[model samples]
Target: MRYFLTLYILAIVTLIGVAGFRGDISRKPPIEVFPDMDRQMKLRPQEPNAVFGNERSSQPYVEGTIFRGMPYQDTPINTGRISGTTNWVETNPIELTVERMKRGQQRYNIHCLPCHGASGDGKGITSKYGMVAVANFHDARLVSMTDGEIFNTITHGKNLMGSYGANINIEDRWAVIGYVRALQRSRLATLDEVPEAMKAALEKE
Candidate 1:
């Protein structure tokens, strides 16, 4: 009984030592595990500093400069619309070459597969974890959407989706759209669309 009582007192002391003063205010500076980050010598925005000739911590963006790996124009490639018009383009402005399609596949696997799925069926891994309303490329509405409209969706995002324009470059954005079209076509394609060289083997089956 004595040993247990002593142990209980020690445990209470330890608990109080660790947590009793958590909410108390202290004047002394707290010990920092990483002092460099805790006291970083960095400029704060909108604050006056002597670093620049203007003595301003915040500076205006340089003229004629766009964000790196981004496009900010109304051209067909950037806007995914008819040049100088509000209408969406029916076709991708960039040529959908084999290389671009391959690149699309790669980029799609990285950025899209997590939510859009490998088949573009919107049944990606996230769906199992309660992510809802992922857009399925095979849907009729998406099938009928113009390539430019799809590009716009990727650039600006829609509904629950967020903008990928900052993340995906212009060329690659078009490439991802091209790859999505290919995925949609995959489910709708007929035997006639198959290559003559491989038609014999499929027909034999």
Candidate 2:
């Protein structure tokens, strides 16, 4: 009974010792019951290390390592051009579908409509803010460019334009290309190119 009472007193005193200490400043390291790999021995990036000759802790990526989620199988789809050649892909690799066009329209409006306008006429809202030299899709030079060239331009950027690659993904880029084509065709359409049903509606108007 005496030993148990003494143990209880000791426990109470220990608890008091732990709980009584509270302050804004702490000089001791934090108590971690579970370290959880927090203090790894591995050297941090750019840390001086003798293992590498230059003492850099970082190393180059493994040879032939393709980055995650980066596509390399379809050259034309991934890069918008054939391998080892400057020839641009004449047509979009993805099939034209209503859903795809809708998505393309959505992407274009978000990323491109600010500069290219709704009709791709180079008179977008940015023009009102003193931006000049926006390219018109209806222009003969742009119309003559193949799908691949346009995709490359979008990926790498052209004069006075920045690359949209970081802003859009691979598939979305193709969709935007398709939508741009539609915009161009609409602006340059002739009576013969219009479908007969549409032509009837147009003639009525």
Candidate 3:
């Protein structure tokens, strides 16, 4: 009975020490067994922060920082391949349209035309410089590659070609790809595929 009474008293003391007397105002902060990061130092935008010399929480963008809704997401749209797999996506993720095609054409002219040529026939000005290694898009090997494979090539660069990933943003890279597809289609499109008006005019020739 004596031991039980002593243990009961100790328990009561422990409970009070841990939780404090009910309704009693305590000067000390409450003990948190599991803090769960309830309180933490954080930098708020536009707030005064001593960490930076300017005393501004806001900071300039770091070089090469690409803005993304989900910075770590692994999707075909971002990676040019199916998420969690090594296989390349079979087609461009961006919707094909005249505007997108025009954007692609513009970017391609700026970047790819130097080597791949205006016609994408591997006859760009670099040919005159004795640079014979540039790839011709119409070749059977290149034509057979999937869109994702081509995107990977554009992003990382294939043999002899340097990576354009740094120069081209993700969406623009896909745009350039869409333009390349149009170029490829230009070579293989059947007369039946031509617009009726254009077909009639061609037939007149």
Candidate 4:
């Protein structure tokens, strides 16, 4: 028993020494005596298994699962419409305030500016890549689109655009919409729309 105990201790010491000693650096998985819970009885993404008939690990969401953080609020502000109607809300449901517009401008710069140019001219930096045409906000057709339609487009996305609904929260999305409208106005603002004082200054220049 004494001899066996001595041998066991020596074996443990040897293992510790081997682990601590430096060797030639190479890309290799280290030896694991006990990888506790490292390998679990769970399916990874896209991992094939014969468990289900479909053999897919990823499952669809169960029915009636609302994704928003807050509980379902059946309103045009949250759903962007009057429950069953396809008609869009003519104007933004959120109050048009300077603070909200500022927030919208910040969110737009972070998300929309990559595809829609700062001036909403469809000349964003990413446009140089092989992407489909981005719509210019100043275009008469887009300008004519109702505010709710524009909000729906941002929430669900249009051609060549992906939905931002998941990425941006509901209120921020509205803010972004407001900022987009502001951009359109900046480019399409008529001389009559300018303040008299600003117009006079521009005329002098």
Best by lDDT: 1
lDDT of each residue in 1-205, candidate 2, tens digit only:
9999999999989986765566645666767776877676888887788998877889888898888987566579888878666578898998879999999999999999999999999989999999899999999999989999999888889998899999899889999999999999887778888888789988877
The model with the greatest TM-score is 1
Model 4: per-residue Cα lDDT at residue 53: 88
Candidate 4 regions off by >4 Å? 1-72
Clash number by candidate, in order: 0, 0, 0, 0
Instruction: Give lDDT: candidate 1, residue 24.
Output: 75
For residues 48-120, could you state the per-residue lDDT of candidate 4 as single tens digits?
7788788888767789877867644667887777656768887789997999999999999999998888988
Cα deviation in Å at residue 148, candidate 1?
0.7
Residue pairs with backbone overlap in model 2: none
Q: Quote the positional error of residue 11 for candidate 2 in Å.
A: 66
Q: Candidate 3, residues 19-135: lDDT per residue as tens digits?
A: 887898988887777687767678878899998888899989999887875454789988878999989998889897889899999999999999999989999998899889799
Give me the displacement of residue 190 in model 2, in angstroms.
2.1
Residue 79 local lDDT, model 4 = 70
Judged by lDDT relative to the true structure, which candidate is superior, 2 or 4? 2
Off by more than 4 A, model 3: 1-72
Residue 33 miss distance in model 3 (angstroms)? 53
lDDT of 4: 0.83
How much does each candidate deviate from the true structure in C-alpha RMSD? 9.4, 15.0, 14.6, 15.7
lDDT on C-alpha atoms for all candidate structures: 0.91, 0.88, 0.89, 0.83
